[model samples]
Target chain A: MQIYATIAELVSAAETADLSLSELMIQQEVANSGNSRDEVWAGMERNLEAMAAAVKRGSTGEGAFSKTGLTGGEAIKLKNYRATHQSLSGDTMLAAVQNAIATNEVNAAMGIVCATPTAGASGTLPGVLFMLQERLNLTHEQMIRFLFTSGALGMIIANNAMIAGATGGCQAEVGSASGMAAAAAVEIAGGTPEQSAEALAMALSNLLGLVCDPIAGLVELPCVKRNAIGATNALISADMALAGLTNKIPADEVVGAMKKIGEDMPQTLRETGRGGLAATPTGIKMKMRIFGQDRDFE
Target chain B: MVLNYKSVFDIIGPVMIGPSSSHTAGAVAIGHAARKIFHAPATTLTVRYYESFAETHRGHGTDYALVAGVLGLPPADPQVPNALTLAQQQGLAVKFIEMAGPSPIGHPNTAIVTLSNEQRTIEVAGCSIGGGTIEIRRITVDGFELKPSGPLPILLVWGAKDNDQRIQTKLAKMTKIMRQQSYNTAAKHLVEFDLERSLQQHEVDSLQQGAAELVYL
Candidate 1:
């Protein structure tokens, strides 16, 4: 089986085979690994199970503080707020925000999480998928298929550009994850592969050049909230694509631009804990406190 | 079976403990891969972190993750957070070094570790590039760098130099070899095999009894 490194090639292959993007990805896995379809599907099912478990444990787990005590209870706070008050983002979007935050909370607490492209940006996909499952009443198979769909596009990003924050910044981490979630959303909502591509481009463009700076160098603060916003970003992008909207630039070019931007980014902005939020007064102070360092920044 | 494309699992899986994949899980993977390459229990372990790995080791739990790996814990093990205590209880004398900023040595997420048993001391260096994926940069045992990449279900077999034909003769008796690549370096011959599946421990034990220096799954 030939590999598709770009959105155009992937869509063309999907159309030629008359298969949904999810099915094409499943086929690709079976071909590459010499595994039966059932085996490949079962593998993705395990990932889905892990992701769902993270979501559950994150929301309900007690003493949720991260090892650093920097990020912990925001997801729980959101859930409580949602139950008592209406959100401007609406229930589905807020639900996505809730789940995304919850999942990252689990990650920050050193709990197990499926790296949807990466652990740093792990929450966005599940944020959207679990909310969709609740809203659309999707079958277990549909939930698993959503992962295969997103994972296929994520591989393209990983190969062509990258999904690493160190190499590509948050644009590549949460940004790519949001784009993957958007594409998967379109497909699960019965949109064509082409529409999913547009959705991906829109999602990437929305968060282009986002840096990967965490206060104290922890996956707390902006990183956790970023997932919440990333979930909403995917939701809005999917809606636009499903509503017959499209970006002027192709999806592949957006990924390319992300790569170039990340390359041009300074080392400090790329997970070095030296710039962006990590360089701020409070961020630096917190870093000193957490690490017990006395090297005061003049 | 050198795949030109990555599997989807490469993107969506590797369920791991994390505040950061490259720092935490990647460190665990590096430690675990080093342990696998050693193929023996280690007593004294010295770990050195470089660049971003050094800077964020405290917040990201890179220290615990690396210790967890040296202790033979998998990347996702919940025991990772308790690794420092666990290592002490297990009588593993562990030393961790975090390099100061801007050293001219390694990638952002790099780990250079030396593990010694009573008889042998081995050095392994690995880089966690991103997304829970890692590249094993160097290994002291057989210089596992000549051919850095291969198909999965791989085995790095250490033996005498130019022993490919001899190892092949030995390996064929065990299982069909889909593909094989070998290089002789640092007085060690390393043969990488794309096998039908991961070899069972008994099978590896039987193979190690041959002239093979070490066999790692």
Candidate 2:
């Protein structure tokens, strides 16, 4: 059997196999690895449980402080504020953003987290999934299905483009992550596989050319905040796709474009901590303050 | 190369302790793989951090994580941060050399590890290919490349001169071998094979007494 390398092939495979994207992924896992479908689902459920636990631990405000004191407490503050104030984005979206922040904050604090794609981009999928669980009243099995759907899309992107910041900047990291989350959210919201692809395209296109420049070379600072933004982007893009929106460019083409942009990007911008926000004067000051002195880097 | 996203866990999680997956978890995996290939923790170790890893490994906890892995700690272990001090108290001679530029093989996140004991020396080159996934590009023991992926149980049988008949006949009886790779250098003949099941301690000892060494990954 041929493996699906592009979104079009994936969608067509799902259609011909008479499977949803998530089902197609489950089938592929069985065929490729020779594991039973139940085994694969059990492993995914374990990850889901870990993600939920991280989210809960992170929202409690304790142990949120990162080593460098860069990121912490924002998730707790967001959760606390939502209890008393009427959030313009409403409770679900606010909770989604907070959950995303909480996951990354935990990650920055050296806590365990399920890296949705990578640790730096870990928060987006869990944030969107848990919020959708409450807002849509999704069952645990449905949430697992949502993960499979997202995995299907992420597989295509990772195979076609990249997912590491060192390889393709933040666009490939958080951008690919958000695209995966958006597509999964669409699937949970009753969007077709094609609409999920559309959501992925829109989410990735919006984050194209985004550089990977964490201040002081830590995954904190802008990274934690980027997960929050990525979660919001996933939610909005998913909604847009559900409401009959489509991308001008196809999903595979968008992935190819991202690969090209990453190739063309200067080495400094691709997580070298030499350009973008990392190069600002304040970035240098923070690095000096954190490390106590500057080391030689030529 | 086609990136393998075999399972949903590959996409969603490794559930690791981290600041960075590529730097921390991946580094640990490489070191752990080195330990496996060495079969025992080395008394002295030399690690070369190349390119981006050399520049930013400190901030990412790559150094401590790699040492923790060498001590046989997993990525999720909370004891990772104390690996440096632990290595010292254990009396392991550890040296870190910062290479000037990208590796000659050209991966940005690459580590070349040299592990040595009184009896043997092993050299392994590995790269952290993001999200706690790694590729063991090359492994050289006694000047022959013994390529093992580091996840499977591999028995390295060396010093058997006759590769065609003697080694294969013996290997066929020991266990069911899934994959095999062979290399020949000046002094010895080496064959590495992944077993369907792990060998007993007696089997390992028998293999080691007969051949040069037996390594189970």
Candidate 3:
């Protein structure tokens, strides 16, 4: 796609170049509009809350569980079951995250994922930081510095790619998060933001077009599991960026590409229940057979 | 820029949980995806979180967050708690997993959400990085990876995907025109902005106004 080509050119121009992701983000935000950095950052958080509410509402609607008539305690029990058995390996960062989410610690740690601003993607980074610190003996200051560095790359991805998955897909969602993590890992390991952003860009570009389909409208099956992979990708992308191997695509161009790919996506692919895994026969059968209705087919 | 000398930490807003703006928002996107994917009454669901998501799920209210999404609630809806309850009352099972291992390729905020039926099971893996953005990482039926984003019936409509050819073509030229004109009236659409503004205004009464503004953004 031309979008991909532009992004490749942009990345090439940036490869081996020196720049911080945060700096890039500030530049991107400024380029996008006149909203103050703080204003844009605030908007990011607001969007986060909006996204949160949307998930909750979807579950409560006539999507899932309305047929069996489950209970709160049952929900908790089910949650526990999910916690007990699920495993995907990549790196130590993945391990730490696994421990945290199983324990419910991501939201409290202040991870910082850099949506429109730093506070928006709080869950991913903090969880990774806390896990790394505990397992890797990373210092508090190191964590903070790492965050700053990671935020820099995150900003780049936000500027280059669609940070909002509704605007794109999991490629933008986890891909951007992993980009930040990759950059932060680089920073924590003593790489420059230039290196970090490169790694981040590489990560985003690599993990594009991942979908966002949850069965019965829940964030279970693959939502939480992908975070582990995203974390691991962050580490790997950092390594790739550090090793001096990256697509010659500008982060912004990648963002542009992501937006286009998402546009080409069908409603089912776009988080609307119309495409991807959501449209499968199993998905349809689950809805119809479980709910005792034919609406799934209709 | 003058040296206002705000603390560097001060420059940073409230701390939070993650995936990334894209991942987190992407999770919401997945919720939206689920809403449209099934097109039926989502009755019972099972959510399983992997590595990073498990650790931070609680603070992010990822559990409730996803549930809220399933309920068709907006991200700013304070009724997230009620929605969780409502899910249970309706007989839905939302699960959380901490996948403790590795994978060749994927995001950190991944989840394997299963919406089952008497005869079939649909499993989806969606990642929420940061900013509540979500994307479908992978999907499984009888244990197989399905490229959900590649030939699926779904489509994402936004500023980035407004047209077919141009890059970053969200809403084609509409978003461009809006951005250029600054005429997009999100003031009434987003609730969180109003709530944040109310809080920023330093007025007590206006706080709820901001809170009520949680929707429409």
List runs of model 3 lying over 4 Å from the truth.
A1-127, A288-298, B1-79, B83-217
Per-candidate TM vs. native? Answer: 0.89, 0.89, 0.46
Clashing pairs in 2: none
RMSD, every candidate, angstroms: 3.8, 4.1, 15.9
Please name the candidate that would achieve the greatest DockQ relative to the true structure. Answer: 1
Clash count for each candidate, listed in order shown: 0, 0, 190
Error of 2 at A28 (Å): 1.7
Q: For candidate 1, lDDT tens digit of each residue in B121-153?
A: 878777777777776645565334433443234
- Kindly list the per-residue Cα lDDT of model 3 for residues B110-189, writing each as its tens digit: 66677765655666667653454344545544333445331112222122212223322322322221111101233321
User: Model 3, range A206-252, lDDT digits (tens) per residue?
Assistant: 87788765333333334444555676666677778778776688555
Indicate the worst ten consecutive residues by lDDT in candidate 1 chain A: A289-298
TM-score result, candidate 3: 0.46
Which 10-residue window of candidate 1 chain B scores lowest in summed lDDT?
B143-152
Report the candidate with higher DockQ, 1 versus 3: 1
- Tens digit of lDDT per residue, candidate 2, span B2-43? 544435566777888878888888888888978877777578
